[model samples]
Target: MAQSEHLTIPVGTVGSVDSVGAVDSVAARMRALDAALPARDGVAVFNRVYLAVTEEVGRRLDAGGFADPCAAAALDVRFAERYLAAVAAAAGEGRPPACWRPLFQLRRHPGIRPLQFALAGINAHIGHDLALAVVDTCRTLGCPPAELEDEFDRVGDLLVSLEERIREELMPGPDVLQIADPLTHLLGSWSLERARDATWTAARALWALRSCDDVAEEFTDRLDAAVGFAGRMLLIPLPD
Candidate 1:
């Protein structure tokens, strides 16, 4: 029952594209990511989960799911641009935002579980990038965060739904998740629901600080550092 305009390829399949900057370029980015990163790589694990979410959103958009498809697309593209920017920076100058430094640094460390990589990336993206992306979307669409509330909520809901799947798909297995395992303790400490709520609050706060350039920059910096700290903790190397 998919719409006629929807892409025929399954979600998470990367394909050739000119660039990752366009709203239609998510699948392309995903495709590049899949081709570039090894299957067991930490970043790839998160990228696959993220790619699925992005493709699903695209399908919903094609089906006219959002009240404002334009707003939804803007939000989606801006959000993705932040993540891609981090990747590019990490690959080149080795200076991504504080929130993203951990994942990039530990991406290939065998000691870090796939679940940890996935959640740490989620923390960086949601805790830091999401607020900025909201502002970016608002600026691009020439509106305020209040105007994009519905789109924001819808996208957040999608993320929330995927969080469960990520855990289930990446989990080390029931025997490995015993209470004695540090992974269990690590997994229990972070909650996507809490992170989503915090991001919404931060977005609203940033929107309010739009006129105060210095204060807003400082606020953003602190948020980045704090999220990065959490990511560092999440990426703690566990024993094999």
Candidate 2:
């Protein structure tokens, strides 16, 4: 995708706010992006999926689902900012993280299925961004990863459920999807449950290495590149 193709959304608009207001702002920004992108655009597909998740997270916050509402809100907003920043970067000369590059680059490829685009985006966000978001949340909230464990798990559980729905709604049906299908193999190689577990570990590791700036930066860079590689694999175009 060209730089001009990525319509700029002012990422800073979703600034720090109280618990309820923070989530509301994130949902609002996502909804705005949903309205701006082409319906069939790959990024739009993922944006719609994320917006649904964000709205659901907001609903849960309203219903008092999280044990630590404030921590939850902080984590949620920080998590969302990483994605919004990537979008903003793609819109300008700034480069998005390696983890997010594939989706931005392949957003308009016709041969890639919507499922592929969705999972690729999920892979990058969950596999790389979520871990850093956890660290970011910890710093902002002045707590350890363990303190934020409940919120992380709750948000992750929501994502896992959403992944199921995405597959159900987007995957080729049994009659059409054959044993030899490349999509099956591609999708099978990645698992959200595993990614979530790994992200938790990475978050903890990042927290531990925080004092070692150089080491932490190297680790983060490696994580970004690895997730980007996985995203590229997930986005491999298959026969329609």
Candidate 3:
């Protein structure tokens, strides 16, 4: 087993506004937009969508609770960390190595640099850490960790070359996904659909990671927050 550290679980809450609309409503719409997604594709896209969701919701809650309650803020932080850890672990463990195609495709977008520098740093590091985790897991499982290890090395190399690659853009542009789909539409710099899908899947996968009897209760126990970073969410006013 890998050397372990104690994990702290922060307390967070979903205010009435967050539980109903900010979270439920947005999540529903985002799912609608992603109706056509393949399950496998969902996994690949999870981290991107998740970071976006946490950043977006976190912003809303932060604004609403800027001076409200510490418990709520703690809850949001815990939720964010749990989701990220799950996403990172997923990217770390798998049969064949997962493709980075989606990630690379996103990189070509016009806003990549700024998005990376700002709200999406978690994605980059989680991505980097997860890629390495996959290698480590593969080694433990007695699988050939060569390809994954190489992939990890490639990303590690790129991470040193730039800032955005060092972190991820919180979800793709709203144009990148439409969680609301045909039922409704989503448009903005960030896609609400991608964010929702990512959060759901990451949480689900993270929750499912334990293989032993104690796995369910013990999983994510090793999770921790990324250090020294700032994240944001925006509420834009569109001009008619």
Scored by lDDT, the top model is 2
Better of 1 and 3 by lDDT: 1
lDDT digits (tens) for residues 4-113 of candidate 2: 46677666432483557788888898888887888888888998888888889889999999988898988888888889889888878799999899999999998999
Candidate 3 stretches greater than 4 Å from native: 1-147, 164-240
Best by TM-score: 2
Give the clashing residue pairs of candidate 1, or none. Answer: 14-31
CA shift at 56, candidate 1, in angstroms? 0.7
What is the C-alpha local distance difference test score of candidate 1? 0.81
Q: Model 1, stretches more than 4 Å misplaced? A: 1-21
| lDDT (0 to 1) per candidate | 0.81, 0.89, 0.34
- Distance (Å) between predicted and true CA of 82, model 1? 0.1
List TM-scores for all candidates, in order: 0.89, 0.95, 0.24
lDDT of 1 by residue, 1-240 (tens): 112112122222122212223456866876686677778777677778878878888888888898988788778877887887777666554478999989887887989988999999999999999999899878766798999999988999999999988888888888767879999889999998899889989999999999999999999999999999999999999986
* Residue-level lDDT tens digits of model 3 in 107-212: 2233333333232333433432342334333433334434333333333233333333323333345674356532122123443233333433333444345354
The root-mean-square deviation over C-alpha atoms between each candidate and the true structure, in angstroms, is 7.6, 1.7, 18.9
* Clashing pairs counted in every model: 1, 0, 15
**Residue 66 alpha-carbon offset, candidate 2, angstroms:** 0.6
